[model samples]
Target: MAEELRLFAGVDAGASRTALVLGDATGRILSRVRGGPGILRPGRAGAVAERIAGLLKQALGASGPVASLEALVIGAAGAGREAERGALEEELRRRVESRAVLVTTDAAVALQSAFPEGPGIVLSAGTGSIAIGRNREGTVYRVGGWGRQFGDEGSAYSLARAGLAAVAKAEDGRGPKTLLTARMLEAAGKVSVEELIAWARLARPQRVAALAPVVCRAAAEDPVASLLVQAAAAELAHHVEALRERLSDFAIPVALSGGLLVKGSAVRDALVARLKAAEPPVNLVDRGVDPASGALALALGLRP
Candidate 1:
């Protein structure tokens, strides 16, 4: 008789994109799918759940009908609170045909991806910024990630917002002129400040965060853009420092993940440089693993 096949699925539901991966018990990937964000905002839980369900269905269908998932794990942004995670887990359980379903913050999975089963830290800066660390005893500590209204200082949204503010200041002669003004004008197709302001009022956070690359491109030569990038790095460093303080006094490995930090951007370089020059000196991992892969590892009981 042939051995029975068992499957698992892992979902990384971020603020900008949602990625799902289907794998067998042997740790072989069967299928993968991508979709819009599945991070449940205050009033968008239902819609996000539907989107995630659809992505799962697509992944399973693409893989084959013979396979049945035994477990599914999801690591989602905006699921920091236990209540929020419970709600998302219930919603996903109803949608997926799996025996067990687990949900956790995206940071948790990212940490697992980086360290597998030990003490370490994960610093993520995409649409938002957060630093999460785990001690040898398995206690987790977090910093930043208060949300866009009050926090998210080192994130793409923060960088884009600063870039736009610089454009406004330069237009009003309150700040020095920079290349960001022309870049913003070109990107937004706005002729005047009034037009830009009108568009911004209706723009979503993801749309605004999309401009971070433009700011990064100008940072090498543009003084205003350079300062903004430096500030973002400082904020990220602050989060790391706070997390470090909560952990043991010994140096620990720090993993950098998310778009802003993982990608080849000025902010990434600046943050890395800053961390390296810190008093205690940071041990940053050069490569970052995907959070979805970490979710899969958790589903397979490879890591706690």
Candidate 2:
């Protein structure tokens, strides 16, 4: 007789998208599914929970009914607070049939994905930015992640907003000319700055963040764009510096995650170079692992 297969499910819910992965007992992934935005705020827990549940079901269906998950782990953005995590946890409990379900902040899982055990730091800079570090004593420290309003300085949304601001400044003859003005006009599908401004007024963070690549591309040839990229890198390095201060007084490996850092781009290279040149220098991981995979590892008790 063949050995029975024990399955687990891992969910990585971020501000922009929610990803689900189905894995067997050995942590081998069987299926993956993606859905809409996650619960990044306490107020949207119910809706995000519903979306996650739907994605879970979709993954299960795609993987076939013969496989049943023994556990489900979810790492969600904005689930840092106990109340918000509890609400989502309760909702998952009511929706998923797994025997074990765990909930934590997305940053925690991102850290686990890179470090697995021991001490390390993980900086996630997608639509938003947050840094998390774990000490050898298992103490977790966090910096930034205040969302787009007050924090998220090194985030794609921040980069996009800065790019737009530069364009406005240039249009008013208050700032140096740059290629970003034309890029913004192209992205907004408008012929004039006034129309672009009108569209921008109604653009959400995701829509605005979509322009980060434009800024990055122009950075190679445009001085203003280059400065913005450099400034963004500096902001991200600050987050690492702040988190490093809270950790143990030792060299710890740092991992960069999220679309902005993970993707091959100029900003990533600049950020890495900045960290490498920092006083005492930061030990950055070559690449980041998937947070959903980290959730799977956690579900299988892979941690020390």
Candidate 3:
């Protein structure tokens, strides 16, 4: 009889989506799967768990036989809190049995992706923003990632919120008449400013953050939008600076991740300039780093 394969999985549960990397005990990748947004909502943790479990099952196939994997590691935003992480871990375990389940913060895996072997900073500005890193002595440093309510500064959500505010101020003559008013209105797919307001009032964080690209695209022609993007850049830079100060390595690489930090975008460009102009400057890792791989590494005990 053939030996039952000892399987493992890792998940990156980000605001945009959840990705899983499936592998076996031999350190070979078996499959990669994706699902809808996996960010843990305040009242919707169970749904998220079900969605992730469905993907895991899809990757494993229906007849894979084993009731549980050897291990599963998940990196999810808002999972840093013991209560939240414990809840998510419990939920996953209930749906997909595993010998060992590990839950960690989204930023933790992101930092691992950027610098799997040593100290480096990863600045993530997706629907939310966060910076997490480590120093020479293995001490970790983190900034932001407090969620939208606690100020997801430099995030797509923040920029969109500010852009909406700018549109409101411009409409009332309380601020400059900027193209953001038109740009954001169009992006929201509303025919009128009133419709835009209605949509903004009831939109989810991801929907609101969708307008951030509109803000970014309009920044080239709108002074108000440009200022907002610039401010976001500064805030993101501040995050990196805070962590860099805590890191002992002077030449560590700095990785920019997420939608808002895409190459050549207004915010990314401004942030790169700001970091490059720092007193001692900074090093940037231009390649993309998949945090799911980092999560898998942790799952397989591939790194410390």
Model 2 residue 242 distance off true place after TM-score fit, in angstroms: 1.3
- For model 3, the superposed segments whose C-alpha errors exceed 4 Å read 1-4, 62-67, 302-304
lDDT of 3: 0.84
The worst-scoring run of ten residues by lDDT in candidate 2 lies at: 1-10
Per-residue accuracy of model 1 over 1-304 as CA lDDT, tens digit each = 1233677888899998999888888777888899987876666656767888898889878866744578888888987888888887777777767888888888888888888887899999999988888988888988988889899899999999999888888989999988988887788888887687678768998988888888998999899999999999999999998888888744888989888875678999999999999988998876566899888888888322
Q: Compared with the true structure, what per-residue lDDT tens digits does model 3 show for residues 1-304? A: 2333777788999887899988777657888999988887566668878988998989888436566788888899777678888788888888988888888988888777778776788889999999888876788888888889877899999999999998888888899898988777677778877789888889888999988989898989888988999999999999888778777666778988888998778899989999999878988878577888778877878322
Pull out the clashing pairs in model 3. none
TM-score of each: 0.94, 0.93, 0.94
| Model 2 C-alpha lDDT per residue in residues 56-145, reported as the tens digit of each score | 889888776753568888999877788888888788787778778888989888888898998989999999899999988889999998
Alpha-carbon deviation at 259 in model 3, angstroms = 1.1
Report lDDT (Cα) of residue 154, candidate 1: 90
Best prediction by lDDT:
2
lDDT of each: 0.84, 0.85, 0.84
